[model samples]
Target: VKQIGNTHNREMLPSCWDLTEAVIRHLLNMTDKEFFYWGEYLNEKAKQRQTQYKGPHQVFQENV
Candidate 1:
C-alpha cells in the first residue's frame, strides 16, 4: 500500500490514511443540508470537467 501510495504522489501515506478516516467520519456525521450542498458542489464540478475527463480504462490503454 505504501509503495502504491508513493507512486501516486502520496508523500505522507500515514497522514493520508488518518485524513481519509477523518473525512469519512465527517461525512457520516453531516446534516442533510450539508450533505446535499456537497453533493451539488461535486455534481457541478463534475459537469464542468466532463469534457476533459477520461475513464481509468482509457488512460491505461493510452499509457500501454
Candidate 2:
C-alpha cells in the first residue's frame, strides 16, 4: 500500500506474512493459551530438525 500511497484496510492476502502475524497477535491478546501453544509447536519443529543439521553448535543453539 505504501508503494502507491493507498490508505485502504490492506486486503488480507495469503502471501502476506504480516496478515497472519497480525491475526496471531489479535488472538494472543484475547486468549493467552494460544500464545504458549504456538511456542510449543515451533519448539517441537525446531527440536525435530535440530539433529538433521549435524553440528554440536547448532544442536546447542536449538536447546535454548
Candidate 3:
C-alpha cells in the first residue's frame, strides 16, 4: 500500500483498483438529495462553461 499525504489528509491506496473502489464507495454513500444537488451543481457549472466552449453538460449521476 502507498500513502498519498500526511496524517491529516492521507490516502492509503494499494493499487489502481483501490482508487476506483474508493470513488464508487464514496458515490454510493451519498444521500439522494446530496446526489441531486451535486448533479445540479455540475450541470450549472457546465452551462456556465458552455457559453465559452460548446459541449455537453456531463452529468455524474446517470453514468454512475
Compared with the true structure, all predictions reach lDDT values of 0.79, 0.74, 0.76
Q: After TM-score superposition, what is the CA distance of residue 50 in candidate 1 from its true location, in Å?
A: 1.5
lDDT per residue as tens, model 3, 1-64: 9877676443553567888899899989999999999999999887777666644543443356
After superposition, candidate 3 runs with Cα above 4 Å error: 1-15, 54-64
Q: What does candidate 2's lDDT look like per residue over 1-64, in tens digits? A: 3467544545543447887898877876865677789778999998778767678888577689
Candidate 3 colliding pairs: none
**Which candidate number maximizes lDDT?**
1
Q: Please tell me which model should have the higher TM-score, number 2 or number 3.
A: 3
Write down the RMSD of all candidates, one decimal each.
11.3, 6.6, 9.8
Determine which window of 10 residues in candidate 1 has minimal summed lDDT.
Answer: 1-10
The reply for model 2, stretches above 4 Å from the true place, is 1-24, 27-30, 59-64
- Minimum summed lDDT over a 10-residue window in model 3 is located at 54-63
Local lDDT at 51 for model 1: 42
